[model samples]
Every structure is written in structure tokens, then in C-alpha cells.
Target: MTAPEPYAGVTTHTPVRHHILSVLVENKAGVLARIAGLFARRGFNIYSLAVAPAEGHARFSRVTIVVDAESAPLEQIVGQLNKLVNVVDIKDLAPRDALERELLLATLPVDDGNRAAVLEVVANAAASIVDVNATSLSVVLAGTPHACDLLERALEGFSDVELQRTGRVALPRLTQTESL
Candidate 1:
């Protein structure tokens, strides 16, 4: 008797692409490591990953993984993930079918000469200045990934700007007639 191969029946002919997998798993210590190790052992690249408690529930955590599908077939990724004993559910969210957001926090050196300009840029990006000091400004923006990208690019015009971003987290978009 032998264990079955997880990807045994998975097949795909389409060109590889990016995939967003929302995984629900038991909130145990090694669950994340196991999932990451699985991808690493298979040589699959993870584009982005975000994990948090699911719906304020202490029993489970939600992991949003943006996988580089170019590295492996989506079916194979999902199949391997399903083999994890801690994983409770998985959702492959199509871009248009999902509402995704990322949080960006940036700190930029500012002074009397560029203070107005910096504030203007921040306002234009719809970002708020969360903190201000004599020499620097800390700004925050919680928006769509594209919006965050645009803001990040715009910030590159300044010097000594530091940025940190929370990987994207997404949920399926709800239709107008649907109720949650």
C-alpha cells in the first residue's frame, strides 16, 4: 500500500499566470511554516503572502497567498495544499472577482524646503500623514494594490524615503443582489 500522489490527476495546458489563493487553516504554530515549506520543496515562488485571524475567530487563520503560477500549475499548488492536515478551506480568487487591498506605511525625510511639496504629493495620493516631526513625515495609505503601487512610485521622487507594505488581502466581491 502506497500513499497517493497529491497531483496525480491534475492537468493543465494553459499558459502559467499569477494566482491568489485564500487559505483557511487551523491557527496552529507550524501551519504557516508547513505551507511555506511545501512551496519551497516544490520550487514554487510565492509572490505575496498575508495571514491574519479569520473574522476575529481565534480558532482559524486566513492566509492569502499570491503564487507565481508561472513556477507551477495552479492545480498542483492547490492539490498539494489540500494535503495539509491543518488547511480547512481554499479559495482561488480571480482578480476581477475579488476586492483586494494592501496597507502601505512610508516615512520620508522632509524639511522647510519640501514640506509643502511632500504634503501635496501625499494628499494627491489620498494618503494621510500619520505622524510629523521637524525632519520627517510618516504617511499611511490603505488602498488597492494598484493605488499603492502608484503612490510608491510617486514617493520615489523624494530622497531617503522608507516604505513598508502589508501584502495584499482579498475577499470575493459580492454581487449587488447578494447579501453577506
Candidate 2:
């Protein structure tokens, strides 16, 4: 027999950390459940998951999920995730070069006082706030995971965060077609 393929991603000093997967699925209830169930069945740790309707129509929904697992089983997870009924396609944004990721966060108390600071930070990070109220604010940001991590570290202590992140939705930088 031939030698093994080294399991694709298993080795000493291999860093198993955060990864975001962009899933294209039918926009319907329980679709999320099946996706989550796949991870549960495999005993993977899901850091966060967010699903929403893709632009244009409600037929398509993009599910972004962050997971921590060694590379060895990563491909298996993606392959399995694609077999689900509702999941049309599955792609890992974390491993691609020139992939763009965005995250939206809702934090309480977005008034005049800290609003400027918040906006300032947003400007620095090239992010945007789409919703705001006297008591809460929601902002959409596009960047690498590091950018989200920095923003969370800075704002979490100061604001009441009802944190939700769209794991990581990405497309090729040169591509004209954009969708989950």
C-alpha cells in the first residue's frame, strides 16, 4: 500500500484555531438546526454562527460559522456540511487569500456621548453602523477576524454588547459575482 497523505492537516506545532465557514443554504427555518447538528455530531466547537437572507431574494441564505478544529478533519466537515438538504454550498473563507469578511454587532446605549467615539473607531476600522437608537446600536464591519477581535476587545468593557457575528462571509477580491 502507498503511504498515507498525512491526514491533510495533522502534525505537531500545528495551530488549531478559529475558522469561519460560509454556507449557502435555502432560506428556511430548521436549516440552521441541521447545520448545527452536523457540527454537534462531529464534536466540533462552534465559536459563533449567524444566518441571514442573502441580497436580492429570500431564496438564498448565508450561514457563517466559526469553528476550532485541526486541519485534518476540516475537509470532512465541509464535505459533510454540503450533503445537508438545505445547504447548497459550503466554503471556508478562513483559508483563502484575498477573502473579505464582515461582522455586525449590536451594543446597548448608542447615544450622543459615546456615539462619536464609536463612529471614530468605526472610521478607523473602515466599518459602518447601520442601526442606532437611544439605547442600542448595530454596526456592520468588513475586515479580517483580527479586526473584529480588536473591536470587541475595545468596546466590550465599555458597552453592553448583545454580540452577534456573521462568522465570516467572504468572496474573492477580484470576483464580480458576490453571494454566500
Candidate 3:
């Protein structure tokens, strides 16, 4: 069997569909733990999660969570989250209505034997080499999940590769207001 591509741009291999949830919560100690515990107790699988301060204010934080939409009904997840004392709001940023991006950092072997070849691959992906040593190169790519997937796949042809991706962070598209 082929290894699972966990970050292949929200897959559909099973009955479960992927959903991106933007959770706004009080930026206080232990709130993250509480939220995580709720998912654990309910057996919800969070594919990717990133939490950081929202609106440059220390009073509130936003959590960008990618979860299996079918593991449980959407209402259940929302209800459970609402019960949390620190949770302020939950927004479902459906794929079509959001702008999503991820960052990938990969280190590949790049000695005289294949330096040119590796550079070619990186150039094709429009990624930049952020670090370089005598034997390896570290490339950084920030783009849509599919672009990152393609770059990762291409780098597989080379040897001694190590990669890490900052799962995903998405924001809902802005809508224009109409004058009354």
C-alpha cells in the first residue's frame, strides 16, 4: 500500500470530508488544553491546527483547525466548542469561500553530483533556497497545498531529504458592502 498523504489538500478517500474551522477564543492560559481535551474525549481527529493571537490583540486568539468533517456531525463539534468557556466564535471557512496557504521547508542533498538538478526542481516550483551548506540545500515554499505537494513529490527523486510543512492557515474572503 502507498503511504498516506495526510496533507494532500483536503482529501476524499473516505466518507469523511475535510473542514477548516476558525475558532476565536480568549487568549488565556489552559484554554488550548481545554479545547484539545474536548476533541480528544469526542474522538475528533484534527488534521492541522495553528493557534496565534488575533487582530494583534493579546486578549483574543484564533485557532485555525483542519478536521475530518465526517468524524462527527458539524453541529456536534460546534456545540461542544460553544460550551467551552473561553471559546468566543467558530467560523467554518469552506474551501471555496476561503483563501488558504501553507509553508514547506525542505532540505535536500546537493553536492556536486546533483546540485544543478536539485536547483532545477526548486526553480520549477518557484521556491527559494533559504539555506545552503557544503552538502545540502534548504528550500522554502509558501503556496497552496497542491503546489507544496508537487514540490515535495519532485524532491523525492533526490537523496537525503528532510521536510516540514506548517499545516495551513486560512481566512474567509471579504465581501463588499452595499450602500443603503
- Index of the highest-lDDT prediction: 1
Counting clashing residue pairs in each candidate, in order, gives 0, 1, 0
Indicate the TM-score of model 3: 0.85
User: Residue 16, candidate 1: how far off, in angstroms?
Assistant: 9.3
| lDDT of model 2 at position 117 | 70
What stretches of model 3 exceed 4 Å from their correct place? 1-16, 175-180
Candidate 2 Cα deviation (angstroms), residue 40: 1.1
The alpha-carbon lDDT assigned to residue 96 of candidate 1 equals: 65
For each candidate, the alpha-carbon lDDT, in order, equals 0.85, 0.66, 0.82
For 1-180, candidate 3 gives per-residue lDDT tens digits of 222233445433223477788999999999989989999999887888888899898899999888887788878888898899999999987666778888999997777767777887889899999999887889999998778878887777776789998888889878623434
Q: In model 1, what lDDT does residue 98 have?
A: 76
The model with the greater TM-score, 1 or 2, is: 1
Query: Which window of 10 residues has the lowest lDDT sum in candidate 1?
Result: 1-10
Worst 10 residues of 2 by lDDT: 1-10
TM-score of each model, paired residue for residue: 0.86, 0.60, 0.85
**Which one wins by TM-score: 2 or 3?**
3
Clashing pairs in 3: none
